[model samples]
Target: MILRDVSFAVAPGESLAIVGSSGSGKSTLLGLLAGLDVPTRGSVSLNGIDIFALDEDGRARLRGELAGFVFQSFQLLPALNALENVMLPLELAGAKDARQRAEHSLAQVGLSARSLHRPQHLSGGEQQRVALARAFVTRPRILFADEPTGNLDHATGAQVIELMLELNRAQGTTLILVTHDVALAGRCGRQLRLEAGSVVQ
Candidate 1:
């Protein structure tokens, strides 16, 4: 197992950071927490629901209804413009106002003028901001971010972090941030340290 006997809880609207060195399973833990991967043992509960108790499709349905994710790579589709990428989740959830909501989300990230730009056309920070807009557009109850600033320079990364925290507060959503930057980890309300697949602190 990549992680063993690692356990913790996050309160609603609370911010938590998981920090560790390379290959220490921080990303693995985040994936399990988000239900993107099932653990070999134990269980993960989201909003009081034991995700492990559900089948794959059921877990996916629940994830779609409750979670938002931001990754180090930004993960925006190259073919989709900022507006379209932000609208993808809302559209999948059958929201009739996906466009309007996506626009509002983009505006929140100060990316309104770049809404028509594709991923390749935007800068790194702008691309990440678009990814943020997409993640928040769903108004998810929880947000999972893994090394969200890994690909940005110092200043841009700080800006992204500030924006994420601002959105988390505004929406009253729980945040689980995974990163190696100690300063970044300190920005969270609480911190978890992992080492060799186990919780060390």
Candidate 2:
């Protein structure tokens, strides 16, 4: 098993950071929390609902309705431009104003001018901004980021961190992130340290 005996709860509107060395189960724990992977012997509750009790489709619907994700790799589709990428989740949810909401989200991330650019055409920081835009456009109740700044340089990473924190505060969205950066972890209201697939701190 990649993770063992890991249990924690995040209050609404709070920020929590999961910190660990490489291979310490940080990403695995995140996957479990996001309901992308099921736990073998435990439960994950979100918004007071036990996600593991639901079937795969049920859990997926829950995620779409209540959660957002940002990854280190900036998982924007290669075929779509920034606006289309950000608009995807909203469209998937059948929102009537997806285009408008997507444009607003991109503007919030300082990507208004780059909205027409594809991920491959933008800089790393710009691409990550697009990813952030996509994550928040749904106005999700919780946001999960896995190594969100891992691919950026120091200065660019700092900018992304600031923007994420700002958005979290502004929207009152619960934030959970996994990272190796001590400074990033420090910015969070609470920190959980993991070692050997267990909470060590």
- Poorest lDDT segment (10 consecutive residues) of candidate 2: 1-10
Candidate 2 on 1-201: residue-level lDDT in tens? 888778788999999999989999999999999999988899999999999999999999999999999999999999999999999999999999999999999999999999999999999999999999999999999999999999999999999999999999999999999998888999999999999898995
Candidate 2 stretches with Cα past 4 Å from truth are none
Estimated TM-score for each candidate: 0.98, 0.98
Question: lDDT winner among the candidates?
Answer: 2
lDDT of each: 0.94, 0.95
* Weakest lDDT window of 10 consecutive positions for candidate 1: 177-186
lDDT of 2 at 75: 92
Candidate 1, 65-160: lDDT as tens digits: 999999999999999999999999999999999999999999999999999999999999999999999999999999999999999999999999
Model 2 TM-score? 0.98
